[model samples]
Target: MLSHVEVTARVALTSVAHFVWSNRLEYAHDCFVCRRVGRTVSLHPNAENGLCHSSERRLEWQDDIDVAGAHPAPIRVTGFDTAGDETSQRLRCRLAFWWSPFFDLKRPDERASELSEKRWVRLHYRVGCHVCRDAGHDDWFGPQNSVQSNQVWPVTSSCQRCDTELVTVAGPPEINLVG
Candidate 1:
């Protein structure tokens, strides 16, 4: 039999794997920003190739992002917005869930009908700013930009209201459950 610690560790590991696998495809796109200048940038899928959206002078930006820190962070789905159609809304929900840091790989296919019926996709994670962690500050941790595809913005100017690091989990109607 598994001890409590063992069980917890197993669960945590499973959760991490699920999150990584589900969102791996999404991150495959070059989605990153310059931590120093707050300028939007992209990292090549192949890091060894040393390719980036900016000039070669900015190559150091890739090294500064700390991709490892982007993983194993707690996440939650917070909310949802729809322009009109249910199908479109569902697609958006799926996309959001795919990018979620707390993504659960087990739930979706099993409950496809239910989710489609409700016109909602479960947002399983929250996004935290790694730059804040590197700065030795915990006050601003939430998404600096609105939840858009492959976009990163400056957390300092955007998250000035909250002194504690702000983690924006999927909230309200978007995420069916509260964290």
Candidate 2:
């Protein structure tokens, strides 16, 4: 078994979501209901094809977006294409800071204050599952990538079924390298 490897990197919070999607890195998040690993369980009761697209396993994005102050930025989602295999394509969505809403605490005033504040946030790509206490399987986590990969994630979430608060892995400190 490969020992747990922790690599750190500095990334602007705004760009972290794009970075993860572009790199095709594997990330493991627990089921909001049973605490089962994202890759190992399906939350949808109607799901029959073994394809899970819910937030329990994926970070879905809205239809329209504003990037760099550009209104209605045409965001595109490009999935992993297996050469000559159209049916095998893997769809991964890029998440942005706006995906997680943050209120402007500084300005309680209604008219003058900005509605939300967007800032770079620190996140951790858990190398393994804390509940299972196993690190033997690489697929249990997100895709493995080079050290330059940028990684960021939603700060808080809840299991849709059980409503249990989901917790992500803690981030690396004082390290400018990303894994």
Candidate 3:
């Protein structure tokens, strides 16, 4: 039999792997964006200015968890660019997990019934521009323009309304169990 630690590790690892793999496409897509912009980006919890964009050209998934009885889990991932800062940027992705027996999870007795309590996971991506801005100007809009001056600001960083820090994860939950 597997020790509790082993079982837990397996489960956690599985969870993480599943999380990473299931979201690999997303990660890759984000990485592609960062690469195109020539900057490093992270796709995990606690990332700085990490959130994704919505169809409406607005930042998506910026809410925090507040389930009644269960807790939340958050992870941060980061990525970087290789072409140097001129056209480079840094990206951060944050994922939050929320649990609620009533809505998110099923009762203990339903474990094997395909209705077991489950945690709801929410993902957010934040891309920050560490280089020069306002590259849309004619002088900054050329193939040979300075890499730093020729970069376009990421839509993920600009607030739709206020145009500020587009997204921010809620404070870490007070209760979290890793077993």
* Ten-residue stretch with the least lDDT total in model 2: 112-121
Give per-model TM-scores: 0.18, 0.18, 0.19
lDDT (Cα, 0-100) at 146 in candidate 2: 25
**Which should have the higher lDDT, number 2 or number 3?**
2
Q: How many clashes does the backbone of model 3 have?
A: 33
Judge candidate 3 against the unseen true structure and give its global Cα lDDT, from 0 to 1: 0.21
Model 3 agreement with the true structure over 26-106: per-residue lDDT tens digits: 211111211111111223323433233222121122132122322111212332211213222222223222222221122
The lDDT of model 2 is 0.23
Clashes (backbone N, CA, C under 3 Å), per candidate, total 17, 10, 33
What TM-score would you give candidate 2 relative to the actual structure?
A: 0.18
Give the runs in model 3 whose Cα sits over 4 Å from its true position: 1-64, 67-108, 112-119, 128-132, 135-179
> Per-residue alpha-carbon lDDT of model 2 for 1-179, expressed as tens digits?
11111212332222112123122332222212221222221112122212212232122221122222211211111222212121111222222111212222333331111111111112323222322224243333333222211234323322233333333323322211112
Model 3: how far residue 31 lies from native, Å: 32
